[model samples]
Target: MAASETPLRLSDRAGAQAFVQNLLAVMSELESALGRESDGVRAGRIAEAMTGAAAKADLAAAYTTGLETAKANAIALARFAPEGLEALKTAQRRFAAVLETNQQVLATARTVSEELIKALAEEVGKAHTPTVYGRPSHSPSPYGRAGANSGPLILSRSL
Candidate 1:
């Protein structure tokens, strides 16, 4: 059996409690980071939001390790610290919801950015295309320009 599934000695119970506590703390930090990222994206500050990536990655790794330990020590944890186990479960649910919001916000940012770029490109292409017979027959809009199936549209989504 894993340590979590095994019966806990007194010493092991203390260790298991500590492990659960650490996991909870990490989950709390992750929730905060996700909240910040979500706020930044909502406010159109994606660069600022991206700054949280490293902190999120580090906290996620720590949380994963602590979670594994907690699982291994589940039996001991339940026996010695039922309340802490329940708290961890609650925190996990909240963290999951925050993560979902973060995903939605980031996706919105990506879509808005792409649309803005496309619109700007179309406007600029229109300005540069020489007028033919007093109309922009050669200008590029959302539709293809004259004499071309469609002007080259290159998009770099590295962001």
Candidate 2:
């Protein structure tokens, strides 16, 4: 069998408890950060959302590390304290729900931003398009002739 497929050895009961506690702590922090981010986006406070980005990233990393440690020690944990394992499972379910909500909020914000940019681009194109001159008193096209031949609009998405 490949080394990667090999199972990790079970940790002692005390170590298992510590690992579970640490995972719970990181998960709590992650949940808080996600809540703040969701509220900021809902309120249209870009600055508030940006402020939590770094913290969220850090907490997410820590949570992942803790989960991996717990998995390696799962056998020991099950033998030592089944109750602690059940609590961790419950916390995981709660975290998943919050994560789903946060994702929906972020998706909405992105769609709104994209629509606003497209509207702005169209307006800018119309304004910059040159008017075509007509012979005598003939009326020009509602959209300037130049507008029809304008280059494709390019949007810069640095955000």
Candidate 3:
């Protein structure tokens, strides 16, 4: 019932055409879901991005099942739905492109979040470190000193 979903008729008579068409519909809907998530994350609409996650998961599962079924009956698909198979290939290529974009968007968001947390951690570290002449006691690289004690940046759970 999603925007890109086409109702499926999975009867034996429907055959390859039905499978290919339904798979395409699922692929399209999944792409739409990913695009919405990417756009929402880019615009800082995090909640909106997550709203259709369950639906996306469902689409992904359906797509996976369709692929498995089609692979098992590749001969049937090739013989009965050659055109549909070609269309599916084209759709799959386009879907791959969308997935790449979605990954890049998510990676960018993760990098920005890590940077923000690092900045906050550094600020907190500064407040606690001993200082001399308006400079922190611990230099950027503490490896020079013998037995220098440095530890990983551990943010509090309260953050």
Candidate 4:
């Protein structure tokens, strides 16, 4: 028979397993038949054909089982719908918004603190100066020079 004219066979895990089992049974039957045959050449040829067919069936069975396992894994992954991804995206957007707000508040606080320090330094400059070793000296403001102090300290007082 021509290769194209032959019927195509497809098998899954269970079908492949069944095919392998049936092929083994057929091989046993063929061996028994060959033993009964009187012509040695015909018997040897039949045994060789049976062996080749069994090997092909075994290879096909392995391929089918591998395909079935891959199909099952793909199906399991598909079970996670788009909704899960959408929920994760929504959470990420909310987190981004919160982070942006925190950054804005920090920037505003930094600007206000800088202005407060500038105003305090100007006030201190206008205050009285002490004499140290016959030279003029003044008590340094906790805010330091123009750009010093690491950060502002928040002190709480109970009313």
The prediction achieving the highest lDDT against the true structure is: 3
CA lDDT scores, all candidates in order: 0.78, 0.79, 0.81, 0.44
Cα displacement (angstroms), candidate 3, residue 46, comes to 1.5
9-58 per-residue lDDT for model 3 (tens digits): 33453577878888999999999999999999999887778889999999
In candidate 4, list every pair of residues with a backbone clash: none
Clash pairs, candidate 1, are 3-72, 4-72, 4-73, 4-74, 4-75
Question: Which digits, one per residue and each the tens of the lDDT, describe model 2 over residues 1-159?
Answer: 235755435556776677778778889999999999999999998676778788888899888767776777777889976788998999999999999999999999999998998898878776656655732232356765534555677766444
> Per-residue lDDT tens digits of candidate 4, residues 2-98?
3564332423445434443443454344334333332322333334434445654554454445334434433332343333334433543654554
**Where does candidate 1 stray beyond 4 Å?**
1-11, 133-135, 139-159
User: Which has the better TM-score: candidate 1, or candidate 3?
Assistant: 3
Clashing residue pairs, backbone N/CA/C < 3 A, model 3: none
- Candidate 3's TM-score: 0.77
Best of the two (2, 4) by lDDT: 2
* TM-score of each model, in listed order: 0.73, 0.75, 0.77, 0.31
User: Which has the better lDDT: candidate 1, or candidate 3?
Assistant: 3
Of 2 and 3, the candidate ahead on lDDT is 3
> Which pairs of residues collide in candidate 2?
none
Least lDDT summed over 10 consecutive residues: which range in candidate 2? 131-140
Candidate with better TM-score, 1 vs 2: 2
Q: Candidate 4: where is the Cα deviation over 4 Å? A: 1-81, 129-159
